[model samples]
Target: MRVIKVVFLFLLIIGVLVLSFLRPDDYLWLSFILALFSIVFLLIRFERRKMEARELVLLAILASIAAVGRIPFASIPSVQPTTFVIMMSGYVFGAESGFIIGSVAALASNMILGQGPWTLWQMVAWGLVGYSAGLMQKTKLMNTTWGRIIFGIIWGFLFGWIMNIWGLFAFTQGGNAVNMKSLLTYFAGSALFDSMHALSNVFFLIVFGNNWLKILTRFKRKYGLLE
Candidate 1:
């Protein structure tokens, strides 16, 4: 299981790197295919382990909540609870399941928000947020309030940076090579939204952190899932 996990994660990383160079209007579709396959393949391996229907339903519910959480905040720019929810899900469930929920949430939300090449990056970004949190499940960072707040704050900017990759590719057309000024400028332009996202993450974590943790932890214990 660990070996398979490494392999698919490698593929996903390669996909992201490839996207940096590929034209979003042209070849990003290929990167999306790569990421999609990684997710499905990893999920297939996970499901083959004599998993229960309850586990599947739990995952689906988490993904749905994350997706729906994005809608009400759609009018508020970068202030949304989706990232916080996905991060919490990953933190409680462990890495692979966290990745699954994050990826599914992105795909589900984009179905309503409208999908494009950008959706792939959103999956990558949010999935990483969850995966990283799960990786810290055994660490002090995942245990302390300040540490969890820091985690949320960091991912807020990261999620924005990941999405910005799509923006860089999509707008830089006409066969023009991407340059440093363009990269810096693009990121600078998005600083406000990213900061808002980061702040919102902190806000959500402060308000809902303990309660959400208890709820998920209770579910995990009661269902005997993801243990």
Candidate 2:
């Protein structure tokens, strides 16, 4: 059941991407609605019992800060590490909260900047980052500092790869336009930004990952989240 659900979710996201190409102009609004709907539905379904209203508010505010941070300092060509850091909301909060924060941040930031198909990509891409991070947080290996550093680096690079691929597919003019030359150019252009982003992830993880985890664990204990 879990595997089926994951596959279905992937297919749903891909279907949206496919639809975006077919109706490029309408993709933003559609993406916004879908992302919001998913966030709200997930929130109601998962966190209603675990978190209070205040924590939920905190999650949104954190995501908003993250979204704003990305807009002014978007990764030069593609891939934004700041975006991945925001996705760490899942690690701090929970999967549902992380997803909501990521999705809402993307939607809200895009609205401020004027929505486009890229907004849709941003929403899905960042949301995936948070979701993946949240999932990693669940794994036993994520308990130690080295584990987090490794995970952060791996996921940061993953975000870079995913964003670059999304750019190729989402912005490419027809399938033929994404040739080796263009792909290499795009990859090279994006590499520097991704490097910085990945470095930032590593730095941030080293500096504050344990502290944030402690805070979350403390909060969970106080709030009886485990119960």
Candidate 3:
């Protein structure tokens, strides 16, 4: 099952990239559908595995916390605690839980902020962020404070880049084929916002990341959840 999931994810990534370059217009809906399908499939697989109820409840609470974390930062453009929360969850839990939290947090928050096509992209991008963090949870790089800070900084830009794809498709040339010029222009335009996001992530990770991870780890240990 794990192998199948990996293969499917790889294929999905390839498909999205191909569609983005070849048919940027169509890529919007297609990528959205693919992401939705992937989430559903993962949920189904998780259910089939009979995940523990305690774990499910823990994930729900963590996801809710992550979603709510975005609300307090509404005044600050391009800055939010959602990424830090999700990353910390991924750091403590496994990849599947991290992905679930990231995806769910985006959807939950959008319910209040209003939803559009961009919501799907946000879901996938944030989901990948958590998923990647979880995959590296035990690695030497993730084991160190500076390494985790570096990871957060990189993901900040990566999230922005992924979100920019949607902007390019939606606002540029009325959804035309993606080209070098449009891609460059879109990124250049959003560079400042992305930089702010990256810096904010680094700040949060440096200040609170270890403490958050410790708290979550304690909770997990106390409850015997996600073991």
Candidate 4:
């Protein structure tokens, strides 16, 4: 069952990428929405099987904290602590918890900021960041403060890059397939904003990364969650 879920997720990502390029312009939004919901459904199903009641509640609280972390940074474009919270949650809990927190935080924040197709992309991108962090939790790289800071920097850029895909497709000329030129142009236009995000992520991680991890880890131990 686990293998099947993993295969499904892999194929879903491939399918979404292929369809994004191949699907007709008129149907692009619809296709993306469908794909987004499909992925969410699968993730929820997978999580439901492994998570207990207490774990679910804890996930909700952490996700709320992550989402709320973005509020104070609203004045500063492209800068927020959402990523730090998600990464710390993943580092302390596990990949599944990270994925849930990332997904939930995106949804929750968008609810206040406004929702659209872009929300889906943000959820997936952030979720991937958290998931990757969780996967690296046991490694020496994630175990060190410097390594964690470096990881934050990498993910900040990566998240921006992934989110930029929505811009690429949204602005493409009707019926024109997204190409290298369009992709590069989009990325170039958003380079500054992405850089700010990357820098802010590094700042947050450097300043608060260890403290956040310790708090979450201590809480996890106290409650025996996700053990």
Instruction: Quote model 3's TM-score.
Output: 0.84
Q: Which parts of model 3 are misplaced by more than 4 Å?
A: 10-49
lDDT (Cα, tens digit) per residue for candidate 2, span 109-185: 77776777777776776777776767677687666777777766766666677677768877776555888998889
- Clashing residue pairs in all predictions, respectively, total 0, 0, 0, 0
**Which of 1 and 4 is the better model by lDDT?**
1
Cα RMSD for candidates in order: 2.7, 3.2, 3.5, 3.7
- Per-model TM-score versus the true fold: 0.88, 0.81, 0.84, 0.83
Give RMSD (Å) of candidate 1 vs. truth.
Answer: 2.7
Q: In candidate 3, what residue range of length 10 has the lowest lDDT sum?
A: 23-32
Stretches off by above 4 angstroms in model 1 are 1-4, 16-48
For residues 1-227, what per-residue lDDT tens digits would candidate 4 score against the true structure?
65575576556656665555555443336444543554474356556566567776888898899999898898998899999889988888877567768877887787798766566667777777777788799999999998988898888889888878766776676327688887788889888888888889889988888788888888889988876
lDDT of each: 0.82, 0.68, 0.79, 0.76
Q: Give the TM-score of candidate 4.
A: 0.83
TM-score, ranked from best to worst? 1, 3, 4, 2
Candidate 2 local accuracy as lDDT? 0.68
**Superior candidate under lDDT, 2 versus 3:** 3
Q: List the candidate 2 regions with Cα displacement exceeding 4 Å.
A: 47-52, 71-81, 225-227
C-alpha positional error of residue 187 in candidate 2 after TM-score superposition, expressed in Å: 1.8
Q: Can you tell me which runs of candidate 4 are displaced by over 4 Å?
A: 1-4, 13-50, 174-177
Model 4, residue 154: distance off in Å is 0.7
Name the weakest run of 10 consecutive residues (lDDT summed) in model 1: 26-35
